[model samples]
Target chain A: MIIALTVLLTVTGFFFFFATTIGLIRFPDFYSRMHAAGKGDTLSSLLMLLGLAIYSLHHFSFGNFLVSLKIIFIMVFIFLASPTATHAIIDAGFESGVKPWTKEEERAEE
Target chain B: MHFIYMFLIMFGFWIVLSGKFDAFHITLGVISCLIVSFLSLDLFFHETKKKGRIAEVVRFLSYIPWLVKEIVLATIHVAFIALRPNVKDNIDPKVIMFKTRLKKDLSKVTFANSITLTPGTITIKVSDDEFYVHALTKKTAEGLPGEMEERVGKVFKEFGE
Candidate 1:
């Protein structure tokens, strides 16, 4: 049962990461690329780590449970840090006065 | 009072993290939780508004499950949009500007973080009275400073609106 759930989580995590890569390559600008990098990257990596944590509990010893708890702690930390990092990068862009990509800019790039 | 409350929570968290109930380790946890809580209890609250702290905590605790539900729904929505071919029409990224009556700094931060955590929207700028949210679609932005604001208002009990 645990193995099945672990596989499902791993696959879902990989799917998000795959989408992040596609979105990164296909998206036209830095900010849009960030949309992929920020949201997809965070969620995918979080889910993957969560899967690993669950897998770590296969034996269910107290030590393994402790290890999984630590993994969850890391997840909580990443949950807080990843979005802050994204916001900081974008805020820096806004401060540097980089104009967001507009429809006209999109056409020009093509 | 908040200092004491903070100390208890910090110690409880420390216990969970350390997972050792030995007297020496427990003593260390108590000491650390006291030092950290004393140093940073202010960080948690901009205004500890004299209302009953227990009630406030209860309200805030109830808000978490609802927020998690929203996060899941928003994630699925974004996933669907991202998976669709030719996302140009689907993703109408734009900055939405809006004003709100939420007064406390903590509530505002909660609102902003809540916005960013949900898919399809990220808070670009936050002024005392207004927000500049960068959203991935028109539908996503349409409810800004609306339903979300109301939910946060409930959480914070922002009655002065």
Candidate 2:
């Protein structure tokens, strides 16, 4: 049961990551691509880490418990850091005057 | 009090990271944590006299599960948009700006990060009371700073109008 749960979580996480890559390629511009990279990267990494933490506890030992706790700590750190990093990147883009692509821009170009 | 709290937290972190409870290792952990905490206590707890801090922390902790749920929903939303055949038809990317009522710096930071984590919206900049955000779709753009502002404000007890 635990293994099943772990597999499900990890697979779902991978699926999100794949979608993020696709979004990065297909999105019209820098800022929109950031939308995919930022959100999808964070959620997928968190899910995969959560699955790893759970799977590490399958043997039920104090050492395993500590390891899982460490994984959670890393998750918390990522939770704080990822969005801040994304904000920094987007802020840099904004500062450098990178214009965001819009529907109207596409219509005008076509 | 802040010193003690910082020291304990640092020591607890050391224990978790070190994963060793032997007397020699434990003594080393204690000494290092003491030195580090003393050096950074002010940095760690700069607002020394804030009342109801424990309660505020509890409320914030309770807020995490809801945030996690929102993150999952956000990822799925992005995935759906990305996977659709006509991605351009699905997305209407635009920059939106708004004024926020959150006064506290921590609350404003929390609100911004929360916006970035949620579906289809990413915070581009925050200057004082104003925020500039980028939204992936019109639906998401229209829902700017909605309940999230109130929730973050409640966390910091900054019920600004």
Query: Of the candidates shown, which would achieve the greatest TM-score relative to the real structure?
Result: 2
Residue B46 displacement (Å), model 1: 7.1
Task: Please tell me what DockQ candidate 2 reaches.
Answer: 0.89
lDDT of each prediction vs. the true structure?
A: 0.78, 0.92
Query: Under CAPRI classification, how is model 2 graded?
Result: high
Tell me what fraction of the real C-alpha contacts between chains A and B each candidate also makes.
0.15, 0.93
Scanning candidate 1 chain A in windows of ten residues, the lowest lDDT window is: A26-35
Off by over 4 Å in 2: none
Write one digit per residue (lDDT tens) for candidate 1, span A58-110.
99899899889888988889877877887888778877887776565577888
- What TM-score does candidate 2 reach? 0.95
Each model's iRMS: 2.4, 0.8
- Per-residue lDDT over B94-121 for candidate 2, one digit per residue giving the tens place of the 0 to 100 score: 8989999888888889999999999999
Candidate 2 — number of clashing residue pairs? 0
User: Poorest 10 consecutive residues of model 2 chain B by lDDT?
Assistant: B41-50
What is every candidate's C-alpha DockQ against the true complex, given to 2 decimals?
Answer: 0.39, 0.89
